[model samples]
Target: MAHFRQFAFKQFGYFDFYHNLPNQLAQQDYKSFVKIVFLKAGGHVVVDFQEYQLEQDALFFINAGQYYRFDTSCIGTLLYYNRDFYCVEIHDKEVACDGILFHNVYEIPVIFMEPATSDIMQGILREIKIELAQEDSGLEEMLRILLKQLIIRATRIWKHTHQVDNEDIRQEVEFSRTFSQLVEWHYTRFHTVAEYAELLHITPKALNKRITRYSQTTPNEVIKSRIMLEAKRLLAHTPLSVKEIGYKLGYDDSSYFIRLFTKQAGASPQFFRQQYQQA
Candidate 1:
């Protein structure tokens, strides 16, 4: 059975806890807000054409504008909040999950919690549920604090998993985070490593060296992957032709775009789109 409790403050903010993912999301303007989904019962989730097995204690972060859906039969809790409630970019200093948890390019945005950590997170969710049920003058502030706590805790877990254990490692993570953030913001318009390196105020060689220190994928590969992912998303979901999609991704030459996509995705765009749709 699908069950949910939602708290919305007009256009300012919104929050909800869903026992089962509802069909209304298909109609909901999902691109307008950020989401955190925690699975208490094992299930499957699909985000941006990628499927993930959601075992107990697994948390998935879905950035705004991403394609998100799930097995509505599974038991889980979903949290939704818009920028007006608590902007991740503006408050990134407080929680530090803007790029690491949400828009991360090198890592999948899912966190697996140990049992103890899971308990702590569950407790925080309980507090949020209780707070959402109340009516008080400080309701907004309380919910924001709770949301920050959740993001902060998740960021810590992600850092630990990614081996951000020391100052040097932390710096590497920060640099990688910044690079990933830049790529996310400009992947549609910029496709070259040199361009991103210029944006980062570093030489291409230095940028490659630093990024490779944090991730096995080179900076160019990262950019390519992001572009390919968006291409795949459009090809799967939109009726746009291959040339249009290529042009949208900053490639004026359709054949070159096709070659690049085939090389990176291991399938031609037409084949990939046809196969994905048939699946």
Candidate 2:
């Protein structure tokens, strides 16, 4: 087995990446780490895979391990920092948010910060950049402070924009979040809606109905999607054989796995892996 090094933020490390992303919509894929885009000026940004849209003055968050594309011709500053950058010890419990706990594609939480809040965030980012560029010995201390400030700001913004107080939406979001977490933990073994329903303390029928109502998709579809996503990730990033990957994901029969992959991804596992490699 091969071990991958975990990503971490280090003291005295300068982390900064800025791109004036060109116009002309293009598809992009990410492997790990989330990105927070504060659209300074842009026509419209589309998260192709999710069918989510963001216009000017809207903030968007993308989780690691999801494939996405952006529209052509938008001018904005992109912040590409690892989640580890914000993991600092603080006295105030409220100063730290559980941003690092979420590591799934559907776990991405996005909120549009108000104009005043956005300006404040941009200013903090600017200060971080300035501090990173400096050669001072205490630069790491300054960067850590700035990163904590940014996380706190984001939490406040999310709290303000959160629409969960609407009971219907709240239930929907909670159910969806719980379902997602369950899938992440058990995708390799439990592949049935009834199994998940039992774990969630809901009837299978009720679970299906709630899933369909909230996501406009059946629980079975959601399960299959999660399975397929794991398959894709393994195929694209690891040197695992199709049979091995299928078996690892709970498909004992490789032929059945190929058929399922074809049904969900419109291609065979080998073909999909080859295509991804070629790209």
Candidate 3:
């Protein structure tokens, strides 16, 4: 039994409400929409080839343009929406989630919820489903409110978990978010810590210290990881040759790119592509 329901307005956007996770999610790519998944049970989600096992109640936030798939299906509630619908003309401001929840590359995107928090979030999801069940004129606005509520609560939870209470800590968080946004915008062009540090008006050493203080990896590692993730995605999904992929990723020297990718990924590009194809 597939428990999938959807509501869409051709002018606005589309929303999917899932009582149970569907396997089709593995096959379909929603490159233009952001996604939130609240899993009630055990499952696995793969984001950019990194697999996360969900042993308990958890929430996942996936930004648009990233390659993701449900490796194991579980009973869950999912919300998918693009910016055009959520940030329509009538809205004065877009949801604050674009930076913290969806685009913060330093933090792992999954939130493992306690039972109390899970119940609260589940209630919001229930209201969304209820709103979707109706076809009234106010349905779009009501659904928008519900979705914004969900994002706001999730952002609060994320801030609480990361302890962004103090001014110093908040400033650090802001730096990290800006760094992430910069990296997202320029990873294809700027591949060095010094480049990003210059953009942040800080030294590479200072940038690394700030990033490593809050996150697990160094600034250089984060940039490399983002580039390698894109390389892996293109290799697995596209028919581009190794040299073509390397050039696309701003690497003119194919041999150097191959060596760097092998060192970082522990396999040659061709081997990795073949493995994904066989799988």
Candidate 4:
């Protein structure tokens, strides 16, 4: 990590890495801290065995223990922090990225940016870079505030992009947001549209309509996607066998789980694991 970027350490375990990152990220031992990378210009990043090509400015919020390899041509800002310094979970209400961005393993690790938002993000990153440069005793609090603002802004963009209808953005945003939360909470035990609909205080029909409208996917798709995302993560990160992984995801019949995963990911669980491990 030290070889990858110029770093600054502030109060109480605060650490930030800002660099004009090269095309290929150097692989050292994996890290135990979370990473918030603000990428601009043009490049690619591979995270959790998935590759993303960034043609525009992007924000990548990655949790601790995830693996990432960046394109050598990548150029932008990178910030790293651990629970000891500042925990996003403790400040969830203030920053609000606990589910949607940071702790979310289902969502992609990239947020493609619009120009206006990109300008603001770039400005904020520049300010952070400048603030960390001097011997300012008050840098911690200022950086915390700035980091919170950045997370809120990034969450806004994330919700807007994932929302089906931006016309009544607020209401629909809440609807979709609550739906996602429900999925995260009960996805393991509850897998039906009607069950989730009941929890959301809406009809199954209304749930599907909102999900399809904003997410461009059916309720069943979201359920399956969440289940499959977890299954994939387990397969990639754990030594669990295919049958064992399936059972953990609540599949009584291992064959059914294998079929579902193959259909969605275009490969068998074992095959996907092999490919990922070899990568």
Cα lDDT listed for each candidate = 0.79, 0.63, 0.77, 0.71
Clashing pairs in 2: 23-73, 24-72, 24-73, 25-71, 25-72
Off by over 4 Å in 1: 1-24, 88-97
By descending lDDT, how would the candidates be arranged?
A: 1, 3, 4, 2
- Where does candidate 1 have its weakest 10-residue lDDT segment? 10-19
Write one digit per residue (lDDT tens) for candidate 2, span 1-279: 011122234322222222324321122323354555666544455442344444435455555555555555444545444546554565243334234224333535555656787788779867866775666867656766776776667665664555445668766766776787788779899999999999999999999888777456777887888898888878987899999999999999999999999999999989988997897
TM-score of each: 0.90, 0.64, 0.86, 0.74
User: Once model 3 is optimally superposed onto the true structure by TM-score, how far is the C-alpha of residue 17 displaced, in angstroms?
Assistant: 8.0
Q: Candidate 4, clashing residue pairs?
A: 22-72, 23-71, 23-72, 23-73, 24-72, 164-213, 164-214
Which candidate comes out best when scored by TM-score? 1
Runs of candidate 2 with Cα error greater than 4 angstroms are: 1-14, 20-118, 127-165
Clashing pairs in 1: none
Q: Give the alpha carbon lDDT tens digit for every residue of 53-149 in model 4.
A: 7888898887765667776667676776655445646686424544467555346646789899899987887777667665666777777778777
Expressed as tens digits, the lDDT of each residue in 66-118 for candidate 1 is 88767755566677777667764667652644657877887668888878988
Provide the clashing-pair count of each candidate structure. Answer: 0, 5, 0, 7
lDDT of 3: 0.77
**Candidate 2 lDDT for residue 32:** 50
Cα RMSD of predicted structure 4: 4.7
lDDT of 1 at 238: 94
Task: Give the C-alpha miss distance for residue 34 in model 1, angstroms.
Answer: 0.2
